[model samples]
Target: MFGLPRPVKRLIVGAPVRADGQELDLDVQLLLLMTRLENGDLAARTVERARRGLERGQIYLDRRPSRPVRTRDVDAGGVPARLYTPQGLPPGSPLLVYYHGGGWVVGGIDTHDTVCRYLAVHAEVRTLSVGYRLAPEHRYPAAADDALAAYEFAVTGAEKLGADPEAVAVGGDSAGGNLAAVVGALAARRPAFALLLYPATDMTVRRRSRELFADRFYLTDRAMTWYADHYCPDRARRAEPAASPLLADLREFPPTYLVTAGFDPLRDEGEAFAARLADAGVPVAARRQADLVHGFANMWPLGGRFVEALAEAAGALRTGLYAGPRGRGTTGGGR
Candidate 1:
């Protein structure tokens, strides 16, 4: 405090001053401090420690097990995925293929296990949580490639999993949400709908929120830049639809359920993507958690509202995935 610069002082404080005058939820406020990511090098040890800190905080919330759902590990195309199915949903239920968010660098199946289980039981649909290849290792196109593969696996292996191929959707939070959007745009076989939770939709474009909520929020602009550096090191590739789906055409995007946290730096871009989808004549249902921060979906330590939010998202996924028809489709993975 005596010698630090203003920027360093702000990082130390880490309290968001919301433009809307809304206060952050108490649990979330505590979590922001407990899980505050380091601002230094994005080295393997640093990232690992950050991930462990997040998981440690998560243990308190994830301690309570999800409603008796059954989960099994399987290869979704070439990608590894954990499939969650409700206890008694019968065969041929809807399926939602999900990706976990970690800026395509950190996070995996275990980090999002509870979220997938909650969705499976609450939404009454099968949930396939994908473990896509991470970046600074696999880089751009790898995660996108896995997302498409996982969707294809869901479509083709539906009957085998006791799911209805036609009633399948693609969804995820943050970076994973970006993958879902890309799959929606480029997958050879279409999904029934999409659920994007505070997605990083446009890496190439910076929005006002990126600057406004940059530091205090869990997802900071500086951290985002670091993630982008790892995920899409090439400047030109950052503009590609695979990396920034917001730049892609959205005319044929399925009905979408988009959620954005008002305090999240990614807020504006996620909203802009929803607007674009709506303008393209795609059915859209968008919600903003006015007092929440980024990563709320997986941060169980934040308590009830976060749980309720997951339920709300699951409900939306159920509604969108099963809305139109009950007819079944042929099951065969597209190469």
Candidate 2:
């Protein structure tokens, strides 16, 4: 499958799939089929195996052309991080402190290099991708602690990193998104804005989307349970605001752009968080990509609706970070 040409891959992923009143994007459907064929069920695999598989899979999926961004390793308050600055970006530009989406066990900075680079170039902002310690080794509150530390580092060290101290943002996909939301809620100095893609907000409750699009999608129910078990072994602690940002106090959250995939199991909870943010008077933009699935942010290399969707997100990030304060209301309209 990796040897197939772009056209061949496109042709293979051209068939559409409809279920639960949502039509899955053709490319996403194809990716799902490939995932099923390659690895049966994520929960069935050992953590080591799953981590290896994700690293290998990224080599094929993250084939987007490299951007002319200058990258360097940095220590984000003791956590490993990579900083991506677009070539020609001026000093004092906006920065995004990023987190990768790997269920807190699988992915790392290398796996999400393309994502940070893409956002750096397209959003015209510097990106600092944090590599927080994984779970079952450094569990529950570990990732969250690292995330807060990293955000603080980004804010305090913005000037040295060639970023505007007042324009720093926080963002991530899935697990990363959860961290970003948590930071937005709990940080002493809040980010200027937030960009979350299909975030896992309420881990404690299995929303309808969880049961409706549980299996066959990139993120499965069993896989979620597996991740939660590894990250926060104490089931009782999953309800804590640190683990479930949807339950966090959002009264002082920064302006946010939250996007959800219609076919993603985490869809409902992500939207619910967005609604909560708006209710708290935080300016927010919420979008639902009606035809996409989970992990679409990493699928931009496929270059079709995937790139289009991500480009829209980049546009929103650029605007949110560069524009003036937005009104407090939910803005929703997505393909």
Query: Model 1 over residues 1-335: C-alpha lDDT tens digits?
Result: 22345465456656655576667755565556544444422223566665665565456656434457788999988899999877767788888899999889888898888788777776778889999998877988899998998898889999998888888888999999999999998888878889999999998888999988878677778778878888889998888988999899888888899999988899999999999998999989989988788887886434556777777897787667655555333222210
lDDT of 2 by residue, 254-291 (tens): 99999999998899999999999999999999999989
Instruction: Provide TM-scores for the models.
Output: 0.87, 0.92
TM-score of 2: 0.92
**What lDDT does the true structure give each of the candidates?**
0.80, 0.87
Off by over 4 Å in 1: 1-17, 36-45, 64-66, 325-335
Model 2 segments more than 4 A misplaced: 1-15, 64-66, 326-335
